[model samples]
Target: MDAREAYSIKVISEIRLERLGLLYGETRIKDNDYVTTVYLKDKPILEGKISLPKFIGDDLYYVKSEGSSALMRQSLYGEPQKVVELGKVLKYEPHGKGLLILGEDPLTKAEKDAPLVTSKRKYRFDGRGLLRTRTSLYLFDNKLRKVIEGDFDVTDFSTNGKRIVVSTSQPDDDVGLNALYELNLDNGEMKRITEKEGSIVALTMNENGEVAMLGHDRGKLPWAIREVILPEEGKRFVCGNTCGSTVLTDIFDGAKERLIFRGDEILTLGQIGGEVNIYRISDGKTEKLTHGQHVVRLFDYDGESLVYSLTRPDKPSLLVRKDEIYDPNPNFKGAIPEKVASSIEGWGIITGDNPTILFIHGGPHTAYGYSFFIEFQFFAQNGFNVIFANPSGSQGYGEDFARRCVGDWGGRDMQELLQFVQDVKKQYNLTKKIGVTGGSYGGFMTNWIVTQTDVFSAAISERSISNLVSMCGTSDIGFWFNAIESGIEDPWTVESMDKLMKMSPIYHVGKVKTPTMLIHGEEDYRCPIEQAEQFYVALRSRGVEAKLVRYQGDGHEHARKGRPENMIHRLSVKLEWFNAHLK
Candidate 1:
């Protein structure tokens, strides 16, 4: 009954030719029944809900049940945001009035909750910013007196409610890094408070609503906690990990306010790994409340217990937080992977510890979990160790760890990975016969890693960028973000190009000694196949064992998005290559 044995050569080839073009994966809603999303022309996006599941995101979230699905979109007012999704009658506050956002869903149930959000537009700043969700106002409503709404951005509040602090008209422009301000609730006056540049990672507000404490990004993570008293100098705290493992701490451990919070990174110190809680600072004595694996950064702490989401691995490719984590009818049917070791926070070998380790991941920003990364679990079922780590640049921790790769991709991130692999060896008793595989940034890392080190016995680089100069213009996002994020844009600029080439694996293909495999969809725009083709040709020309895999019309995420059978085929080929090279 082996899953790999179920696929026939003919079946896989048929899938490769037919199904490997679009997002055609089968989700097993019931036993042997497959489901996938249907984004028909002008239709509300629908996923087969035979078993009924919920989909949650940062703001735009939906919870669909047996026949009826309820959606909640954040109102322009504050947090505890609300959206309307009563059978696709998408009623949302577009500008002033509640208009139809999503017309209607074909599938309807008997009844649903249609609570109309009464808009009380308390305009302060002229809404001249982007209509993007990031700028949309989100706050926990405490001003109206009742717990009706909000959990808004806690970064821009004052200590007295009279004068609000806000940056200048060009606040966000130079705020390339740390930019926060306070707005006067009464006069609608913006006070240009702190001029730090970096992404604001976390923020917490005091009971008075006067003091909006912020957690600014520190290039190195676990973040060092700092409380910026609005329009004044920030107060730095020595919080975070001293070592590798996570230790629970109280919330108000740093300040005089006894807001018992458990944080690994107190925003100023090192990463003291553990979930952070700040339910009640309790006369300055810290008490750790809330039981969940990941720490819910205080979105906003009211006068009562700290209100935040609870995150844990309970489903496929889905990290559940808040109430959704405790959904009665959860998504996944099998067990998700738990932390294997303290030091290695998000990286570990699958417990079943399958031998053919097919370590697959993307992002260099995306973290792997028991959530909906089905391919990892499938690899585990197919007898692979399946090691994944949230390395330096992955999200979910905070701004610090996420920014560690800025201007330094192969330096610290690579070292952490080497340590991660060593940790895997110790934790999972893994051998050096490791198979390194990934896509996009991950694939870039795979290609980059093979060129620099012989740590992995075999490498599979899928849809990766091998040349930095070429990638600058070729990639869909190459013009700006890819460089700014990587701390390397304008590849043509002598200095920037030097930085790009320094990190690019294509520059030093002579160093690669491992047998590697290159897989790509011909139409991939993110990391084109030309990079893979060049690497393969070099490896083959250099008398090293290498193979190139190309799929027609498949883009960057096609291997996962393509048809079910093609997906199964990609799985088969990846595993087969690892079996031939790693096993």
Candidate 2:
């Protein structure tokens, strides 16, 4: 299969409900062009380079990018009309007969002339770039009115006509914890509501002023499973001890529904092992509603019909409404990965042949499950067997397992990965030629593997971490992530520095003999492009086979949401390198 075949795939995401019926979004990639279409009741309603389409009453509201971003509204069978100009609209919700939007305000003349200055601990984010402008929630009634601005960022909010609950974090506070505030819709008065330490990613309210949220308290480490919490009642419900939302995926679907209220029952998506399904909680009892090996990316229920977007190992995303299936990419003929049995418990292998590629997921907390992975499918189509596993520090497993790699990044988890590879190679009678590749935490492991042993024939480290000491000050979340992940209160301390150095791959780069290829996004603040640069220089200085591929203007999410041409070029380059080294 040609790497260019990636253009043939289409993905459906953000299953929602409108006044008429089901509403969803579809994305299509063809050559260098990327197009998105909005569908209502299984029919195309609006099509453009727009995103985050929502139905407020009988009108469709969405964000469109034309040089900059503009909020556009279109009625049923009517033309799209521009509502307002916004700077990267993050979210918008219906408020009474108007709208409540959260986004960055346009730069004023004075602001644009002023130097970039900040007193905050963290000033940058991975995908959103810089925090130069403050995010604010605005009310768009007859005229635009500023409701409130975030000290850092306004993460999420929910309203019930009379009042609204907003979740935000201060600049100097811990990024893991967010404070919830309730604002009066009439008087504009606001008060903090949360009396506990937790982060609320999503929230919903009932007519009776009851609020339920999907978040975690970091009780199970930084990657704590998100559970449904009722702050007013001081009660919480676990979704099988798993996350109450979908985990990471390569496909660029917009945000998924985390928590919603179906009358008195609370509905959420639960991740367990290699599957994500729908779960309902009512009267202190939790029940799984849907069962399958596939991942339900997005869903909406209206007391009767249950509509959702699902993806399997062999399928791209398709919308399912009751018994009817709506596939956006019906003509996609790309290669699909076939699941194979693995000797290692909780590991997954997609069959192909010799010269296998062991792909590692990024989060170390995020898991690879029974879902469609375009990258894995691309490798399989190009004649390479793919193997992946959750290891110890992954979610969807129990809390203990999810936090196993905490304070032990390259210790037990690294050893287990090495053992799993050897065991799988022997079990499948694989060839000696094998490649190791990953991004973020997986990238850290790839760099570590090359340093620890020369078992791999080739290595591709993307947006990886090389030096923990440098990462403490460079990466976006490094200030706190380093301390939490390393179990060190202060990473700058001499003793903690020693521990961090021992876990850093760059410390042991002298032992690396495997031919390595470093890929990085120039704008990636999460791992920082300097990480790849340092490793590349180190390898080249030692006369080892090495190459560095930098993607200009792309960020940490380049692999999943970068421009179509760059994505295709990346795949082609990887295939070429693997073919030359392994084939």
Candidate 3:
């Protein structure tokens, strides 16, 4: 398939089992505009520029953002009606007999007219952009009502109809650590449940009032493997060392149920040996329920049957239940990545000894596994062998492996990646010419790799970080992420600055000779576009071959969910650059 063909392939973003024994799935395709289609029983029921649809009772509820944000519902026999006007709904779900919404409150007249200023450390987030107001929980029974409004921001929440458990972050402490609180819907009273400083990624409550949380108590760094903790019982359930959550993937933004309660068991997704699968924990023993070489994106269980959306190396996303398969793009054909038997775990597609493009995944914590990547398939279809690996810093291994390259970004992990490239070349007897590309943390490694050695014929770094000092202040999570990742407690000190510089790729850019291209979005707050600008200027000043492509009105996820034209253009440019340099 060509780049445009790959872009046109429909991907199943989400799947859920309706109470009426009907399967609900959401799919997305991009051409002139991104279109989302909701399916019930494998038939299209709703199609438009809307998203996050769910069926509550007899009404189909969905969110529309064509012009303004609004929650609309359609009954079985009536047209769509506006339930309420949501200013900026972060998350909403069915709670008890009403709907619980977490969103930014509407701005007041005086506050909107006043100067925009905040003392909050995390004043901006990556996907949501700038944060001007604190988020509050609103309950809708007969009408929309603000139930829990506070000075803090809610991270994750769970409810049992009558009461709600919310994880909140205050202004003083680190934004990554949150405190749990229980809020009563009857009297609007709130009480702190946990006094420990930790991060709760997801949580759920059973009917017996037992709460299961997936988080760590800062024993290790932020990349610590999340455990299932019974907060009230003060007992941590040993599910496994690997985290039971989905790693970073570009295909979909579906619901990730990290921790959920079944009748007597706790079900969660766990990554092991580069594959994410479902696991069930009961009687203090963890059992792997599903097995295969595919990444499970989202899943739901209805007592007897389990329905999930999974993607393989050769296939896009599809729904699977018992013996039935609900593939959204059944006719779309593409290349498949074969497992590369090397000491370092990896996979690749060989195009008959063609010039290999070594791709690295972002999230020094996220591993590259049995997931379908459109970008890789596009490169392979264009006559290049695409190869990727899970180096030392990647997750899905043990906690020790995940934290190996925590403070040492370019140390062992970089060496292992270079070694893996050499092993692939030797195993396949390929040419010396090779191209390297990656985004975010992978981009940082690409920059670091070129500075260390010139083995690659070309390099493309997308949404990369070049300097740690500037990143600490510029990036949205930089203040805490950089400090914790680099093992520097006091980032503002002179000694810490020197240590961070030594680990940064920009400090060693003068030694780079590989032809490099930097791609970044103008609104990327995670890496910030300035990181690319600094590296581009450094390479140009040194008279090294370099190019920078900037996408307007896009963020760090430009390559994944940007405009269709921009996504295709980015792929074409990559192929053109690699062909000119390597082939």
The whole-model lDDT of each prediction reads 0.46, 0.79, 0.80
- Report the C-alpha lDDT of model 2 over 1-583, residue by residue, as the tens digit: 7767765678885577766777788887754666787877778877777888888777888998755578899887788898888776777887774788888777656766777777766777887666776677888986777788755667778887666898777423435467678987677777877776576778888766688888865532567778888887888887765745445567777655568776688888888887888888888899998888878888887777778888877777878877888777777643444444443233434454567898877887888877777888888777787878777888887878888999998888878778878777766788658999999999998999899888889999999999988999899888788778988889999999999999899999999999999999999999999999999999999999999999987899878888777788888899998988988
Which residue pairs in model 3 clash with each other?
A: none
RMSD, every candidate, angstroms? 13.7, 2.2, 2.3
TM-score of each: 0.53, 0.95, 0.94
User: For residues 1-583, what per-residue lDDT tens digits would candidate 1 score against the true structure?
Assistant: 1333332110000000011111111223222223434221213244543111122222323333333434444322444333333332211212111221222333322222333232212111111111111121221232211111121222222222233332221333222234556643334344545555444433333334433333443422222334332334243332322211122211111111211122321111122333333322233232344444444322223223222322233332221233433222243343356465634455443644445353545666545533324555566665666666667765446557766777776677777777777777777766546778878777888888888898788888888878877776666445454567657536568888887877788888999999988888877766767889888998899988998888775676555444345455677777777878766
Candidate 2: minimum summed lDDT over ten consecutive residues — where? 339-348
Q: How many clashes (backbone N, Cα, C below 3 Å) per candidate?
A: 71, 0, 0
Mind sharing the TM-score for model 1? 0.53
